[model samples]
Target: MLLLFAVIALILNEAVAWSPTNSYAPGNVSCADDVNLVREASGLSANETAWLKKRDAYTKDALKSFLDRATENFTNSSFVDALWNSGKTPKLGVGCSGGGYRAMLSGAGMLSALDNRTSGADKHGLGGVLQSATYLAGLSGGNWLVGSLAWNNWTSVQDVIDNRGQDDELWDISNSILNPGGINIFSSASRWDQISDAVEAKQHAGFNTSLTDIWGRALSYNFFPTLYRGGEAYTWSTLRDADVFKNAEMPFPISVADGRYPGTEIIDLNSTLFEFNPFEMGSWDPSLNAFTDVKYLGTNVTNGTPVAKGQCVAGFDNTGFIMGTSSTLFNQFLLQLNTTSLSSFLKGIVEDFLDDLSDEYDDIAIYNPNPFRDTEFVASNYSHSVVDSSNLFLVDGGEDGENIPFVPLLQEDRDLDVIFALDNSADTEDYWPAGLSLIATYERQFGPQGKDFAFPYVPDVDTFVQHGLNSKPTFFGCEASNMTDLTRTPPLIVYMPNNRQSYNSNTSTFKMSYDSAQRMQMFQNGFEAVTRNNLTDDSGFAGCVACAIMKRKQESLNMTLPSECTQCFQDYCWDGKTASSSANVSTLGPASGSVSFVTDSATSTSSSSKKNGEPQMPQSHSMSWYVVFTTVLGVALGIM
Candidate 1:
């Protein structure tokens, strides 16, 4: 048929086009250890503070442009300029929450809306917000979005998605990750050999290996845009050398994970939170409160000194490995291979390989030569702790229920004035965030093991849903005096939770795959959620966002509050209230609970193109997705 021919033609047209601008060339890969000769333990490194100073000017210029646009008609527009001219810059951050591929796709949409590079985004979107951010953090699947962007020189998420058929496209999730042909450009058999050989090399080097090694390697094929298929030459520390980052052109990126003592199944607020940034890797928790030079991760160090006089390790901090360590929960994909549609032979291969992993090690990333092994100087004396002799084991950061990775931004030393938290978590029965991440974080700040950081008062989960807070944007800590402690003023929070607008973007957290059309729909849904469908329904949303940005500075300078800001606080900020709740039986589906969905005028701002009520792929894109699906399956079966 003509339709079949058209599909085949599309497949052939896209199969071999490789552009120089989008791909990298072969380069040298060093496996040698490169250690910094000096070692010292410090709570906050001087390098980070110095970098922040260099970044301050850049932030001011970006914020000025954004504020001027958002506050165009406000009477106090002059006050915004005065604050900037007086060197009273507002510090800002953005936090992305985790929920597997659903979270990553939605986070990408929010980031695109924040990025000025998105087409016409500045007209109504939160453009230049990302540029003004001092810190950006992610965990689990959210790490894939942040890590991919950081690794690719802060490439626009729109660009990444648009390049679907190009050879340079890194997020090629149409091909299942377990497919041998999906690993690299080599023949399927050779690619499998390469992956196995690489892991064997690490094991032979006396390092412990876990399912995370394989999981991370598979993820690189989807996230790392390098000519060297497995990202073998791309180390996480190499991000420090990029001219954009070295010159402080982008916000600092932080990836998070939860520390689990061996044999432990429960994760609580007291669990040690570990972070990996460009400069270092370690915990801010008093238990193991020292960071090690990230480039030398595989080195055997004790008491902050290399055990071997001249020995060090460098390449072990591979980009894929670091991302994998932050999202070790993906190892479940390997454990549950039987549940997939993979051919029985391929499923057998996965089962046979994973069968060797013990129950405790199945979900953990093993970091041999633990970086925090001998920290006698730390307050908790973690030198002989459970992790020291047994090595470091980490799982998904959300395991502790603090899914937003806000720990780094909460550090008092950072002094962030506002934070825009994106909640793409699947906390409710319908698989949408119900402020669970925020509640978990607020509770942690008040626990016995709580840090000195202050957080805004968040009501119970019932209050969050009853007020429609999860379905619409809300402001927290808009007034500094409303904070729990006057001495520890926290940053203003602009909470944007995922909701249906152009599409129902709340895909189940366990759903592992998305067609190109579904992926694009998810992006559009998130874009509309954050921008309230480009402020079509609520024209004042943009101005309210600007007010949130200026709250700290306005209060600091003792200037009269703008009328628009005062009105915004009244409309968007939650006033203290509580409600009692008992489970209700009314429901939409057989398995559904008594969920109350809010009806906002904003939800109908735009209509979807799909007649079935779910967003659909365009005709051209639908055919292209079919071609890709057919080719991947064909190649997979051919390899077998």
Candidate 2:
């Protein structure tokens, strides 16, 4: 009993009480002393360029494995040999869109299809592609998914998918973000008390506190359960410590965020897009194109160097804080301040917290001693707002309308040959994506900020819906000649928007809660959509994916297209078609059994929390789980 309580006590460290100077504070922070402290984000950071060498070490085997399965029909033995001998195989990138939990779970399903570890994926479905890919970029809700996978030491999506509903599993969203305390874990009071105190610690340590901090902490709980040390100290740069990642065994993870000049116009395609990777966090966009070393954040830097030599800060890139920055849409949780079950004293702290922050900028994440302040004198396109301000500002990546996070992949530095764009944006009234993100990305190329980058042309939303381009898989930038210009040509895009095939994955962008059963249906629908229902629905799906991967590389080598590649292009490529009419659909559901999941309830945002004002985990579980939970809980609480 004592031993059990001891473990429970440690797991519940924050469950009862927590008070520290905030590991994110300057003096108390933990520093990382490897790689350059900072540099101009004129292109990819030197650390990232070096890390690419390590990543290629893993990609060699992965590309070979995937090509062995994908290139069976194509008999270009010498071309394959050239690719292997010269190490010039195609570079692949995957981008996931933003749509809260809907995006996270749905994207996970698609990732599982690409992941060879999934049961029978290599034999009966599309797999090995994720391993072959070099970059995995995500935004908003997608950030939650990608960040969780990397933070957990690169666990497979199938592992997270298969573990749904288990209290200890990575994503236990049965409990809403507002309230993460569940029965199998700690009590509701314990969880909220911890979150409340953590926020206070940041403020007490002399940093600006916002709803993003609280939202990030709660998100960490859902993704990294108590068994994973509750992830309080898990910084994004700590990804360097993961042997799998260090060895280039997993794809590099990039979480996307957008810069917003407070009190300026809302974000648009012109807004600077930023990314958080293990090595650095900055933008390739001309808007303030500079990157500070991820580990050395929170330092007083000027002109990309520390203002005070040898004096730098760390821990500000806390995993939750970075993820929260990308998805600040969750900052709306402050509106639910009256809904939590915190004590009157704690509740007062939240009220004062709101009073201290400007309502207009509550959604923006703060980077104090703004790393780029006054760097415009030496940097290119450093916006005045970024130069004059003492802090850096950021908002949700989706706010700029490029919800799919394709910008980072489109950079010339990456030079990716192909991209699997898994767009789960709620871009339509029915919550289905209508290819708006793609169009926005294409339009940005003509803008002043887009001169350095190249992109494939895309049609409007109406064109997408009318031609069924948004309904299933569609190919963009297929014709190299048409896409080429003075700059480098962009990669072929395999656009896979979320569609209702086997199940309804279209949950509202604002919908906050989902029970285990509903969550599973979303995952299954996404998995099938990508794999063409595990090759049963569309047998040629795997070959088509493989063909897309090899298209640019084959063309570069002046090789002939196989019959399979030719047929795939004819069937799926857009082919300069135009549609003048709009095709509107109410809901793409066979209704998923009356679709009560859409109705307003305590689990949704239209209302407050339940009677206790906390989103508790569902009680639907095997009696055995409850029995063990009760036995364990009774001992921990001294009620055995």
Candidate 3:
């Protein structure tokens, strides 16, 4: 019973898994069916179809035979010898020779000259078409065989050639085996059309019949044998369907900004090439009422008996001026101001229309007299300079002070003076190396300084700290170690030190002292909360220290004090420093000035009790047996 069950299961499984060898599927058609459909579509004659089929079959067979022979030769001969011998044979089809038929014919002469006139001349007529075909086929086969051998032996041959040995023997053999007749066959233009028609027919049939197997077979009949020595034949239908044929069509033109065609102008402001009034600033204006010529530089008498003067006037220099300069000059000035900021204000007009419009202006493609090619001139010439003045000025030495027409007004009170001090300490490298890359996230979120004029790097903490203390209130990025004396003259500092341990005690003391110190009354009436921190790691420790000092100084000047000492003490509470309201302390100023200081010994002693090693005591000691016992023991020990 078990054996029967097993056999039945095996049979059922095999039946379920089995797939039919041949089954009709949608969009599948045979190659023969595809060819017939194409012929029907193209309306080709029976003779044409027959001719293509015969030629294709013969060519494929010849290519296959050639490949086989070549492979065998390659296995037997050295690569260098094979390549040299291979060149003697004639290539087949398009691009057969290195330079095609022209090169082949030039090297070997006409096909008729090489014919065996003494033997086969009687059989083939004057046209010699049959003889040419046969000779070409044989030559193609020989070339294919030789080429394959050369390809296979390439590595070995290259090695010998690179070593600079004799290649003359090989070259001689290749030249001697030339078959001139083969060139004639490939040169036939009609043959290419016939092949093309056959390929088209196969492709059309493959598309309509929905028979992939037939389509593949037809493709194998077309390209494989011709291209790669029949390793596997491909049909023309397959190559067409695979997108090779699609590339033969024409390409689309590239797009341009303006709707006008390339190499043609949409606007002509100067009216040099196209006809229009020269006085008009925008496009072409024919009506003379609104567009009149102007004299840019003229001599005139004004307000005196004989006052000689040169002034720009409208509607004068008509024939001499190519385009009236007055209106264009005014428009150019407005355009310049519109595109630039006060920071990059124009100094003087660099090139006036009269100067730039000279013969030398022709060198500029935009300003070309030919309106058809001067689209860029119409776009850019209306402005004094398209780019910023800073960039332009930096290029031609410094700003030309002698020639400048205007000078910028200086507002000393509104202007801020900032001095940057950077730290070049070894510790900075781990975080902000000298040439460290700015983070992309930071750039996207916040604007950084321009590429030029960034802070310079300074090595060591002392120099940076000193620079910070001495710099303006706008100075940034300083450290606590930068300060000379903490108690005597605590400069207003604003920096978050990297190694907190280095400045923890000093920072605590400074914050507490500033809160209660009387010297803060000399400065402003505001605290450090309003200040901004612009110190990047690249600013270095010195810069940071300087910035911090500046902030402290500003805070002293601006910060207002609360009414009572209790509120003030709470605001600047430093457990590390003494808490006192003593009036005996003297006042001390900034390092550069005098400051007030308090001499409170009791406060100092109390401050020491809050040292790092101190232990905390509970508020209720009466109920805490541990505290009570300790107090009692201390009292008894002191008495003993």
With a 3 Å backbone cut-off (N, CA, C), the pairs that clash in candidate 1 are none
lDDT of model 3 at position 33: 17
TM-score of each: 0.82, 0.84, 0.12
For residues 1-640, write the lDDT of model 2, one tens digit per residue. 9999889766665442222223433344333333235567667777778889988877778878887676675655344566666556889999988888889989988888888988777976678888888999989889888988877878987787677666678777665554444354456667777777766667676777666777787777887784333566566777887798878888889999888764553566777788889988877766666777887777776766676655566667778889999988656554454444675545764565455443345567888878777775444444566657787788888777678889889888888999999988876657788787776677777776687777777765656776789888888988787865536678999999899977888876655666677777887788888877778876877777777787887778776656767887888888766553332121111112221121100111111212243332111111232343453343334333
lDDT of each model, Cα atoms only? 0.70, 0.71, 0.19
lDDT of 3 by residue, 35-87 (tens): 11101112223432343344444333443333232223232223223332443
What TM-score does candidate 2 get on C-alpha atoms? Answer: 0.84
TM-score of 3: 0.12
lDDT of 2 at 293: 82
Best by TM-score: 2
The window of 10 residues in a row where model 3 has the poorest summed lDDT is 401-410
Model 1: per-residue Cα lDDT over 414-512, one tens digit each? 889999999898767577887767777777776644555777877666667777888988998777876635338889889999999988898756456
In candidate 3 the C-alpha lDDT for residue 328 amounts to: 15
How many pairs collide in each candidate, listed in order? 0, 0, 59
Better of 2 and 3 by lDDT: 2
